[model samples]
Target chain A: MTTLCCGGCSWPIPVESWNREEGVRCPVCGEKIVALVFPAIARARSGAQPEGLVSETEASCFYHPGSRAVVPCDECGRFLCSLCEIEIDGRRLCPKCFENSLASNRLEAAETQRTMYDTIALALATFPLLLFWPAIIGAPAALYTVVRRWRAPLSILPRTRIRFYLAALFAAAELAGAGFILRAILRLPRVQ
Target chain B: MAKNKSIYRKLTPRRRGIGGFSQLWLASDHILLVRSSRFVEQYRRFALADIQAIVVTPLADHTPWQLAALGASIVWTLVFLVVDSTAGKIFFGATGAIAIGFSMADIALGRRCRCYLHTAVTRELLTPVSRLRSARAFLERIRPAIEAAQGTLSFDQIAAIAPAVTATPADAPPEVPQAPGYLPEALFGLFLVNAVFVLLMQRFPNELDNVLPTTFFGEFVILIFALARRGVRDPRRLVYALMVIALLFMSWDAVGLARSFTHYMGSVMEQSRRGRPAPPSLTGWVAFEHAPAVLAAGWRMVAGVAGLVAAWFERPVKTA
Candidate 1:
């Protein structure tokens, strides 16, 4: 199923030989296969570095990668890749830090779940209401969700800030709409 | 295979809604599994396992369209209650608006998500291949609840724990009957119809605008209400979801409004001391230029959504 691509045409080299891990070799170009899905992907077939592509070796884990782990610890944010990874409490941790961190607390997961639930609930609420009453209520709910997640200790932030972004944007729209309505209603002349 | 914790962090996050907003990711397992926006946003690792099912039901099941319509009705109802001039016309306009918005919502429901759900769930069912009957039976196990939500189980006499009401998004409208939806060109047909409808209903002549308190075209958006409940194959859940969103938005608006009034009053008193009479309303104190159109649009969206939810109760269910 795999075919090496040609460097000159950028098409797959004939289906006789292709490796996604190694990338396609260009028969006409005589360069290392760097066309589509090829080997030596770290270095181009021409052996030139592309502008944005970075070699995996050069990229350092925020923590120590030499400690023999593939994954970063979920708590301390250490770069403990697969082999060095371990379970601490219920979450994944680096082997060296797992038992030690286990003694600290288990509040992280519960708090993360709580905030996530609140945010999804509120974002869903914000969209339907931004036209209804969002100008007033949307901002506060969005803010509360943001503050709850952002203010938490770095060790335990909700893994994502997506809800806050969604809620905040829609809440702003809702509030603006409400303001517009209030303005229009009051401007009409009274019967007396 | 051990779970790769590092895979969670060393990740690039992006979203694509190729078909009705379902997201997918390049997982470490080298497969693209469809995911929830919230879940993908939260856990960097795409947990392909969580997807239980994917069903490609057409416009027959969406829910947001109804909520949008409901939003419109509520807005008009408030306006009629306050404006005090054209009661019958306003009521007629508002009720019609509610209906159209909800119907649109219903149509939008089956537009996309059912297919996504069916695809995702069936993929899981196929991993073992032998689990097809089990999977179908499992879904059937929840069939009554799903049917009750969809309002398909009439003879069972068992009612949904949730009562049917206006525009609750969780109520599962009955499934769209199985029809082969292949007309690759049908999308073009829909686009043409949509353009004509918008022109005829929404962008009518000013004479049309003059006759109605609001433009007749204003009623067109009610279509969105039916779209929101597509995920709910049952009536109860659809209603419950709609109720939650509608109530949440209304209460939120009510409280904020009271505060804005006070803010307006304080600004007025400050302006009045210079010998000008205070206007009875905030229009003078605040801005009125774009309020009505904006408010109407917002209402229209919510009303359409709410109506779609309400209409799910009227859907026909399969008798299996």
Candidate 2:
């Protein structure tokens, strides 16, 4: 069952009080927010164990030798009892395989933290340019970063490497300016 | 042994850390918010049965800030290239990076608004999870436990009894529509636009005269009218609104001061390195840059103090 909570405070909104579609003021915070309710099916319990294990009479679970095996894990092909069996995206997986799949993010729906290198590179290349002085060092740093992270994983959402290109271009410009300044400084004594 | 194990499992709240390093524990009967700093540890508990509502506020749009940061970085990078001072370039570069970093964080971060757990009597804050997906998942994990402890088939029983009206889509989840953002967000956006315009004008010495009018009007518009809008009808809301506006102005000015002050100090240091005595006349710049910030901070503090006083006076009405 889906629980609807007050938007102003996390208290469970009384189901009876909520209409199918309407705004309601949270009694606790007095903030108005809309609540929409929908139907849902219950998920079968993952940790349920078998009633009994029969030796020799039935194919037993790999983890629970006594409990009858319900299905074979799609990935590892291990026989699993009701407790060990996990169905994900229409594929039956044993507990260990399911966990591994989650860790590896083989399943697209798995939640995983990803490092955004493009943003970091852009920030590194751009911020130091603001003061005019840091860019001498920052430009090179940014260039190096762009090159290093060119193949790095980006945000989960689709993003282009336009930031990377921009960062590289700015860094190159900073480097060119720095070179020009160094040449002018060197030529000052020659003119003297 | 079995009883002890069951008691342990039921009593222990499912613990998880949210985006801001804040921890939340969902127990069999209550939710616990745990916040710890160097000096203090604070824990607040809201009983599951007592939780009257949960609010998910929508995140304010930050696209403008991201665009602004990106534009500023590119412009400053070119400016830094033209400027001969190495120290200045590096300083501005770092500052620009930080600005962009903040903007990016704001843009990339989850969109979940502040989540509050409200009881029958008082409202409590939960460590706001940034992503709606994460927040919803957290709620799903805790809902069954809360319902079981309450001993009422308040939520789940409805699914069983309520007809699965085929016309109603099977996968549709209930959602809370976003409320309008805080008024101060619009005010702050306006104030920042005005401030940026004035600062850009002040970049040139001859354009300095235009700065005063712009700054004056901007301040009056943001500070004066913000306070004026509340009017006299609801004194409590007026005080609250004033308090919020003051705090926003204070923080905004403080960040500006910090950035400007760093740049100013860097220029001074660069001059000293060139063996030239720092010009005393530049002292005017110090006051010019910082006076408003100091004033805003003072006003914010005063408003905060006054808010406490107002709250004291408001006790009777609140209870009533």
True contacts kept of each: 0.00, 0.08
What candidate 2 gets wrong by more than 4 Å, as runs, is A1-3, A9-12, A24-33, A41-57, A87-92, A98-108, B1-320
Docking class of 1: incorrect
Query: Candidate 1's residue-wise lDDT over A29-104, tens digit each?
Result: 3343321111111112232222321455553444443433345677678765444566433577755565554445
For TM-score, the strongest prediction is 2
lDDT values of the candidates? Answer: 0.38, 0.57
TM-score of every prediction relative to native = 0.23, 0.41
What is the per-residue lDDT of model 1 for residues B51-141, given as tens digits with 9 covering 90 to 100?
A: 3222211123225545665666656555555454586657866776776676664444333311122211132211111122332333333
DockQ leader: 2
Candidate 2 on B1-320: residue-level lDDT in tens?
A: 11112111222223334322345666455565555431133446665655544555444445664676678776655656756789988877777777667666656754545555545456565654445545565656665665555543335555454453221223334543433223334444444444454444446533453354455455556554545454332344544565566647655764665566567778888988999898564442442344664454355445545654554554334321
Give the alpha carbon lDDT tens digit for every residue of A33-138 in model 2.
4443322213221346585765688888999887889889999999988988876666999989888988886753343355556666677777988888988888
Interface RMSD of each: 23.3, 16.2
